[model samples]
Target chain A: MRKTFNNELSKMHVRFAEMGMMVHEAIFRAVKAFVDHDKALAHNVIVRDQAINECENELEKMTLEVIALYQPVTADLRDVITILKASSDIERIGDHAVSMCNATIRMKGSQRIAEIEVEIAKMGDYTCSMVEHVLDAYVNRNLERAYQIAKDDRFLDAELRKIRQRCMTVMQAAPASVFSGSYYISVATYLERIGDYVTNVCEWIVFLQLGEIVELNPSSKNNL
Target chain B: MKVKRIRIIRTFFSDAIIIFIFLTVIFLLVIRQVRNGSVSAWGVETFLLLSVTAIILAAVDIFGRYLRFRKRKQNLEALNSRLSNIIEGTKGKHVLLEPSDPYYELSQSINAVQSMKDMISKSFVTQQRGYFSLIEYLTIGVMVLDQDRKIYLSNHAMSDLIGREMNLKKQLYVNVLRTYELSQLIERVYQDRQDQHAEIKLDFSDKVVDAHVVYVPVSEHHFLVMALLYDITELKEIERMQMDFVGNVSHELKTPITAITGFSETLLQGALKDPKALKEFLNIIHQESLKLTELVEDILSLARIDASPELKLDEIDIRKFIINLLRPFRPEISKKDIHVEIQIPNGCTVQVDQNKLRHVINNLVQNAIKYNNYKGNVWLKGTIKKDSWFISVNDNGYGIPKDEKERIFERFYRVDTSRSRQNGGTGLGLSVVKEYVEAMSGKITVDSQVGVGSTFTVIFPLELPTAPLNESTK
Candidate 1:
């Protein structure tokens, strides 16, 4: 029975890793579609969101089954619970990826302000790294890495704020592109939300290790 | 030395006391006899003689016993030295004792025990050698950790995985592995006393390894953690490639299907009432259908190539083959004002599948003409080697970038996606060409420079082999 429980746990780990990879790909392609202004690629990203949802549902079901069957304790219990929470965050990140793609689709053929695009791309990269690093930390049980990801989320928050400010100025200057301008803001907002979701994953990792629900980035909570 | 002297003194002192008591008793008896007047016939000489004889007999007996004691001590000392030598594994001769010596049988027993020990130790050494050799030659990485989490054994495969030889004896597993996932796996195995598995990516090496760590119980209180590492990077890459292939196929198929559907739906939504609009839309529908047909054909060819590419080989005249192949492209060549050069020696023949070879040549020529700048040159050259024929398609056009040269032949890999779409060329052309070329027992290579030119060459054997080559030959 213990063997079955452990095997199930390992399967859950693999599924979580796969989900993390899928979310990573979604974010990457969504950002690429936004930067390249390729609607087809954006559509592809949107379609892939369904796969991510399915993965998350499967992972959630597996986690619940393990919990109900084994009633794990201490570290094992902490790990399963963390996976449950983190998989939700990952699924949310996937949703934000779709939202970013949706924003890209709304932008259509309009030219984005070059500077804001760069800023948003930078934010996208930062959020992606946060997600990737947090996933790695969860897998390796590296508390330091999780803490680092949480710290990096602050920089992403600042970038998102700057992008939002820049988008407002651009909208005021070019009233004709207000529609695309709003999408630019929306993309930035989605990326920021993704960063927050990654930070939430880091928090879960912290809880898994310390059994304490300490927020690593307390100030970002208000923004979220 | 002091203890031995004390032992000797103690032994002799007891004997001396007993002899003294006897002497005293004899003297008292003599005194009694003299007092009773019973010694009237006894002389002093007789008395002295008796006393000397008794003392000599006592001395002889003591000396004889002492000799025996000394001999026994010497034999025991020899036996002890031999035993120590055997324990130390030194080559030493056994002590030979006289048969009359009391320690003879003891000496024989000591020799027998030593020989048995020697035999057992020799066999143990051989077994150890065999065990180490077996481990050294094993392909799977193996490491054993004792109950203290110290490394007790590691194989060559383990060292290779680590990228260096490690002094693993008594070394902590974490200090050796340095990978947190694997270390955690080992720790879990140790704690749970069960087999555990993890997929670990190493920081120092570009490898993904599947590690199986098992707990081996040596005794009631002693156990070992054995870890086996199997590199799964290639398997992972293949898996990713399969996933990418499926995704690309879906995306590629979706584009034309969407286009065909949209245009037909527009026509059906009353665009057919406008004659000019209807014509344009029908043309687009026709073009998308053609593209769809090409895509399906390319997919089928790729699938065929994947599933047993059986070639029907035939000898073909190179000059005639080129003429026939270029006949269809002649009008396009002239329209684009591109210079066409065909340099094939007359009577130059090679063995290949005629239909597959035609397909290969056609794809390369089409790509050459389609991608070439206006009035650029396309050269088709055939040369003969000792055992093979070389056919090359060289184009002076918007050449491929240097890095993309390697992947240009990959299925659906395009240098510029929009450009390929504009040129109306399915991206699978080069991949199909590669497959057909390889199917005919040939090799293909490409060289390209950005904005300069690109040359693709295929080499085919002069005569097709009657039998298949060994699979390992590839």
Candidate 2:
């Protein structure tokens, strides 16, 4: 009886991982689109997120079914529970990427905002790495490594803030540049928000790894 | 009845006395008659009376001897049965008596001796079974000593535990000590007579044996001692595992938290005066804070699953369930340019805890999309087989390694941990999926190869039970 239960759990894990792959792809392309400023690619990222949403729903249903039937214990129980949590994070990550795409579309065709793309690109890159690192941390049960990625997210935020501050100063120096500066700020903000989402994923990873609800940031680091 | 039997014997004695008196009276009468010349004298009559009296006395003596022997035989048989029962693995108090079966005073003294004997026997057996059983069965080493420290019982397990068979009888338990700790315990229990226990550590075997001893006072001058044993090898291993788990979790949580808190503190101290620095700090703070939230949420979910596994369950249609779930993700799918195909029979239902099952299905489907190739098509299929409904989500993505598949369900376990994080996986997804699936009495499996793609299947048995309805209630 226990063997059968374990077998069932194995199947569920595979399915969850499969669904995870889709969201991972969506985010992957979304990051690429942000860097290349390819409208078509950005559109693709948005479109793929729908599949991620569908997967999120389906995986949740599967996990619930398993819990009802098998009543797994110890590690098996923890695994299913972690999947339920991970799907949300994965789905949210997909949403954030698509949202970024939307932001890109909004800021498109505005030449004045083009210069800020560099900073936005930097932020996007850092956010992308954060997203990737947290996913890996989740899989590896490397809570330490996962936390490090979360810690590294600070750098991405700092870049976004600097871009935002520079855009404001430019707007103040040349009142006519207000429109352009606003776009820069928006892009910076979007990148910063993406970083936030990535951190969210990491927090869940830590929780999943440890089976405890600890703050991802150290208590002493909570000044912000 | 005994009094009546005694009365009958007394009556027989009186009757004999009366018969003697009558015979004497008859003789006198005959003598008188003969003297008077009324009758002829007869010697034969006198001889017959004398012979009958002799026969009656002999029979009484024989009967008395027979009664005495019968009583003694009954008493001996009762005593023998009691002794045998006590020896046959039963515990209690019973007295042993001397061989003499008659005389009430002597019997009482014998009973006293019997009590002491039983006490000694019980203590002996208890001690041998308690301590020797472990040494005999679980380990190799067999050695036991009596109160005087004489060897009493030794088994093969004891020999193995001790590394050799050693005669332990008649020697002081302390003086012959192979291990000082064990000897000390024996001495302590012997002196105190109260319950005492100790752990005997073995350096060679790297094992610990728990030993317990108790002194039993059987009489004013006699005492009995007993000991118990147990092995804690497996227990020690579990302790080590628990410690490792804690250590790993602590370090993992500390790093990120430190960065977030430290950066925030630095910004607050004076960085805010510079808008750029302040904004940068804020951004970092925001990101770290979000990560902390996710971590907390994951931990909460894990704890919830572990603590109250008996969540609510309900019947849900498989086809409708999948369809309803898909409604929310259509936007994401369109944006990703991914195609999702659903193959499920209409009206097929499975019993499941809705919240948990939704989580499982959501995790798997999301993965399919997140890792799929550009413009990849995901097949979501459901079928009924025997008593269960099988559902699968197939994705065309970089699949998992064969070796990593089994370990994937472990908490925080990952194949390519770094890449998994890159994909925004918390690693808890598959593990949680496994836990809920098992709890629901369902089965989940994965078929995958690196780069070939992966197929995940979930089998949920028919869960809604049919109940007979009473027309009145309806």
Candidate 3:
């Protein structure tokens, strides 16, 4: 009986990894579209978000069935629970990436503050790093990496703040340039939120490895 | 693991007592019915009754022992398979033990061992996985160094970053990294057990990488260090190229702008009174403006090449193309008193981008004419291979130095800067030729001997990809 349960758990693991890859691609393509003014890529990211959602639903169903049928305990139980939590975090990251792509589509062909755009790309890089590291932590079950991922999120947060401050200063100098400047702020905000969702994932990894719930980034201000 | 207490002696005592009482009652009843029978006369019947009771009790005890032993045998088999499965990292069959099985406690212990094995094997697999398989796909190179400052594990990405495949296990960290500062950084991280990130240039290829050294505590006292090396060589190259390009363009533009302004100012400051001086000054200004215009146009087209470049392909006879390309160069060819030889077959034809091929021919032929000595020999050859075609332009000109051969195709790089500037060369022809050639999926190479001669070859693939490559911005 436990043999069947373990099979189900491993299947959940594979599907969760697929969701990880999809979210990673979405985040990557979304940032690329925003920076390169690639509307087609932006639309692709938006459309692929549906697949991510479906993957999450599939994973949740599988996890729930395993828990309901087998009633796993100890590490086995923690494995499924971690998958449930991490999948939700990954799904939310996909959502944020889609919204970022939306802003990218809207900001297409507009005059951008060049300096701020460069900073936005840097912010996007940090967001990608955090996402990748958190997923790595999950896969390797590395508690240290989870904490590091949460700590490194501070870089993304600082990048967003830097973009915000610079955008304001530039807009004050040339008020008409506030159009793309606003888009930059919104895009960076989405990246920041995505980074936070990655932190939430890191927290789930901590729960998996240590079997405890500890918020690594409290200032992320997660409501639920 | 539950086992019920079974007392053979106690159960046998109870059975014998009941049988004895029943048989004794039967014997008493018989005696009461008999006319003159005594208890001694029924000795054989009593003995037979006792023998049957003993036989029945012995039969019951043997059957129970046989059933319990069979169960124990089955349970032991299940436990064997279960234990083997757990040891092999697979889900094992349940060792369902009957309460009376002798090794029920043994099966229970296997269950405990299985769970512990699960945790242990899971960690081991993940650790080895991160060391080899998982990190193999990562673009960032990862290496783990043990407490003895020796290589514990590394992935293919690390070998790729190091520019060679090597036996990385058990090697010293300093030997593998080949950067003293990086070794020092690892030492500092080990001392403080803090994460440190630095930009270090590898000694092998001089690639700049972000060396993120993390102090990974393996256990309580013993710790290892993990270095995540993210190669930013391409990024640094792009940044350096952008900076160099900006600086070069500004300098290239400023040279002529300064001359135009300087001579015009002189012309206004009384040099305009002398008729010859006025005419020469105006001519200098005109020439400088023309050079400036040429430079600007070259820079603009280079930018276009950096964009999505298109190759207008056509089938052209190689001989005819060359003859047509050399038409405008005839004056320079004759002025240099050079003998031009075209050793190409009459039927050599290729599917090529016409204008791009023209640019390639123009640049090489123009350079040959400009650099050749008086009566120097210049030869051109075209050959069609099975899968590729190449055109070689050979000239007995002042050849390039071996050190500068690679940089000749770089933008704004000129061999004889003074001579080319005086000849009104924009120093962009070879680089432009390179761009045009690459747009048509071709390569350019040069073989030169400083005083002997130089051969510039342009080779193109016979077949073209029907679909355009993915567009990447420069």
Candidate 4:
């Protein structure tokens, strides 16, 4: 019975790690679609999110089972708890990517691209990097790096500000460009959301390791 | 000690009986000698020796019994102190006793009881902490009263709500009885040991606090009273805003919609013969369609922000960011007589969702420029302090009213509704700012007065590359 419990726990950890990786990949692929304007890639990312969603459901069930059956404690319990939390965040990131995919499809419908595409692309890239780093941090238990990625979102905000100014200018010059501007604005928003989910995942990772939840930023330490 | 006393009494009785037997034997021998008219010296000597030995042995036995009794009494007193300590020790943890101790079974049971008590009190402490923290965090006041009508516990929120502790010793219902009808209901329930609920408006200093009271009998001698505070100030404002939103949408759209429908009706009735009328009707219809589109877009954006105010943060270069931001606004800068100054230092970075952050900054700067007089200056500055980054936008424009400063962030809130309408403001910009700023773990504050200028400053964390501070981590 003990051996079986151990095997089941290992299986759950493996599945949770896979889910985190898939979310990381989805975020990257969605941003790539935005940058490259590849509708096919966007469609793929949108479709693959279903798999992540399934993984989330399965992880939740497995975690609940472990808690009920084995009644694990300390590190073993922390592992299950973190997986439960991380899966939710991963699912949300997938949903955000799907939203980005929908935004891309909308932009395609309008067939109008804005002049501030670079700014939007940069924001997407930065957010994707954040997701990738956070996932790696979770797998390797690299809390410091994970925290860094979470804090890095503010820099992304600065880039988005520039994007907005460019869009506003375009809107003022050509009133009809408002639709295109709002679309790009939403794209920047989706990227930012992806970054936030990554940070949440990293936090869960640290919590699993330390049995404590610490703030990501130094300034915000006062909050804790 | 009682057993030792019994032993002592038995020893004294045994010694007296032995002494009586010895004396009787000696007396009988003496009587025989007197009858025989002669006595032996050895016999007398033997009698005397036997009597002395009995007396000495009795004295020693008495002293020994007294010592044992005293020792037993002292041991009993020590045991009582040890038992009391086990029950009410200062340490929260419990310790088991050895099995060989005199009160081993009792000690084990006591230890078991002590352990259970520790668990209960630990959980109770945890719950108390959690409850008070929630109350303190909430913008509500809660008070718990005993059956005697005295305050047993009051949350910090409740204290802040009532402004002072005047009602701490008094009947809670009596204090707010005049302000709310619900207080009387609570009083009735508490006095009668029945369930009661009430809603009262509390004057917490200048601000009015809407309080919902629920009185539940927790025990025969104690009652639980909960006061839920809903800062109706915001709720009332939201209600007004919703009314204005509906009113504004209808009023704004009615003009064009009415014109289009009427003109179409007229044209259908043969007014199409006149080219002027036909062109005018078509123009009105086009304008109305545009208005509908704008209204739909505003509604959609507001809904989106309200539904998911969850914006993510990422890292970006501050110097390049500012340069990039200003590049597009160059035209606005050149066309208008406004001076746009960026006072942010190079390499300054923050963590926030790039898009929402941009939206807020763009809206503020745009508003500043839009409201500024000709040749006016709009200053955009970012300063980093010990723990946070403060971004300020100052504009010399039509200032806001003191009351409106706080309400300006409400959806569809406007200082001058007419002027805002003329400027094509949908009144959702500041509300969006507030939502995004708060979502990004930042605070937005505005300092303004009538006839003076307004300065809106957004303060966010500086070490934001790792994570934004939120309640979950704490």
Model 2 C-alpha lDDT per residue in residues A32-85, reported as the tens digit of each score: 565544577789778877777887888788789888988777677778888887
DockQ of each: 0.02, 0.01, 0.01, 0.01
Structural similarity to truth (TM-score) of each candidate: 0.49, 0.33, 0.51, 0.43
Q: What shift in Å separates residue B457 of candidate 1 from its native position after superposition?
A: 4.8
Better of 1 and 4 by TM-score: 1
Off by over 4 Å in 2: A1-224, B1-252, B275-280, B327-336, B464-474
The TM-score, computed over Cα atoms with residue i paired to residue i, of candidate 1 is 0.49
Error of 2 at B171 (Å): 50
User: Which CAPRI tier for candidate 1?
Assistant: incorrect
lDDT of 2 at B248: 40
- Model 1 CA lDDT for position B201: 67
Cα distance off (Å), candidate 1, residue B160: 6.1
Error of 3 at B436 (Å): 2.3
True contacts kept of each: 0.00, 0.00, 0.00, 0.00
Candidate 4 lDDT for residue B292: 70
Name the best candidate (by DockQ). Answer: 1
C-alpha-based local distance difference test score of model 1: 0.79
The C-alpha lDDT values of all candidates are 0.79, 0.66, 0.79, 0.69
Spell out the clash pairs found in candidate 1.
none
The 10-residue segment of model 3 chain B with minimum total lDDT is: B172-181
